[model samples]
Target: MFFQTEFTHVIELFQLPFMQRALLGGILTGIMGGVLGSFTILRQLSFFCDALGHSALLGISLGYLLGLNPSLVLLPFAVIFALAVSYLLEHTRLWTDALLNIIYSSSLAIAIIILSFVGQYKGGLNNLLFGDILAVQQLDLVLSSLLLIVCTIYIGMTLRTQMLLTVDESLAIARGVSVSTQRTVFIVLLSLVVGISIKSIGVLLVSAFVVIPACAARLMSRTFTHYVLLSAGLGALSAVLGMVSSAWFNLPSGPSIVATQLAIFLTAMVIPRLRSVTHSPSTLPPQV
Candidate 1:
């Protein structure tokens, strides 16, 4: 009776307009994260995405300093930054990690300095750093939905080419793929995704969305397609479970979702091992 009551209460909670919006926003973000995250993991650009997330503050700060809307500048600024990083990496001999670190640290410092001068912010910094999915408005949902569609169409068209490039640059080049151009395009897309997601997932935890689900799916998938699909499915599942838990327990939504993904990753890790142990010849009853 207690379990049924709890379940019914949770169902009723979702009937609220705010909860519905949060659910839609989270699902959109999750799907985009999973789709782009598969490539992020494949190309070992997890840190790149993380850097973009943190560096988004610079864009937000710039908006405040210039008396413009942060939302207006955020995506464009992220894209430019990503392009610059890509250009430098291609043309320079700097180590990828070192270059990214330089940019990440410097961007954060600059943003802080600018914010200090900007006097007051409409939304507190914690909201930017931690995110509040329950605060999602209709505009946020519409933007997220549109971005998801764009991301899906782009990924669908370039899936094969991107996969080949990820597997082997030399092979990709041999097959007439424009390696540099594709890389640039992907980085730009990643920047946009990470930039937009920072509003809901927060800069600190956004990378988890792109990394954890893919990592979990990797453990159980035999094919690349399976990995991609499972990662997206897991992402959506985590978001829903986390949102539900957040409402029930009155917890922070972003961290709740990230925690849920972490739990799923741990489960994925254990399941394969459990299967292996169960199928071991030693565990079999005389080959039965």
Candidate 2:
């Protein structure tokens, strides 16, 4: 009994190379997801991120068909598709939502077709769609790290402009913010985050990383900067905990991490309401 219990505990983590990689990948993924997700939620672009994720599936298929690296091929493709979508939305009379749906559905179908043709490999589609964080390579790790640094620095330096644009684009333009240029930059950065996270979170659940933590932060933070920071922190915590838990239970890391995030989101949603009820209105100062 003692040996069995010990073995179970040991297998959960601190025993496998794949487990380490998954944990590291999750941390990086969370950072990037949290940073981009704040803008994603604030700008009402969660749908856009989902579209980008689906569109990236096309790139993944092309990679498998051509025997190239999926991450490399998917990165440029995601950026291109995101740019195309954003451009079409702004420059043409097309309905942005409809256009996004078209791109999303088409890309996903194409990927499924291509994957069917590719047939079997060791956990191919499973890794792409649901993710196998334990199988993350050094190349993918390096790529994610670089993208995370670039995004953090870029967004930090342009915080004011991003916040302004998120709240009211026309007003931001009136205040001398270049709407067109800023919008383009924002879309490109967002796409990069999605691309980088593809391996860690997979196509199906990547948007959860972007949406859940930001929603949690919304409950906890009052200022924009604090909200971003809080979201990032939550993301990191979830990544670490999920990775460890997955390894221990021999579960899928991507889903485990996302489950952790969902738990946080639920807690955030509930706590505020509970506080409102428990706190006394009579003791609190009256609102202006």
Number of the top lDDT candidate: 1
> Cα miss at 67, model 1 (Å)?
1.2
TM-score of each: 0.94, 0.90
The TM-score that candidate 1 achieves is 0.94
Number of the top-ranking candidate, with TM-score as the measure:
1
- Please write out the lDDT profile of model 1 over residues 1-288, one tens digit for every residue: 987888888899899999999888888889889988988998899998888889998998999999999988999999998898888877889899899899889998898888888879744788878777888889888888888888888878888887898888999999999987888777887888888888898878989999999999999899988888888888889999999898778789999999999999999999999999888777546855
lDDT of 2 by residue, 1-288 (tens): 976885678565655676677678889889888988998898889989998987788898888889997777888888888988887777878777887888799889988888888876435777778766777888878888898888899889999988888889888989998888888887888888888787777888889888899989888898999999888889899998887667667677899999999899899999889999888477767889
Model 2 regions lying over 4 Å from their true place: 1-12, 120-123, 281-288
- What's each prediction's clash count? 0, 1
Residue 149, candidate 2: alpha-carbon lDDT: 89
lDDT of 2 at 77: 89
lDDT of each: 0.88, 0.84
Error of 1 at 72 (Å): 1.1
Cα RMSD for candidates in order: 2.5, 3.9
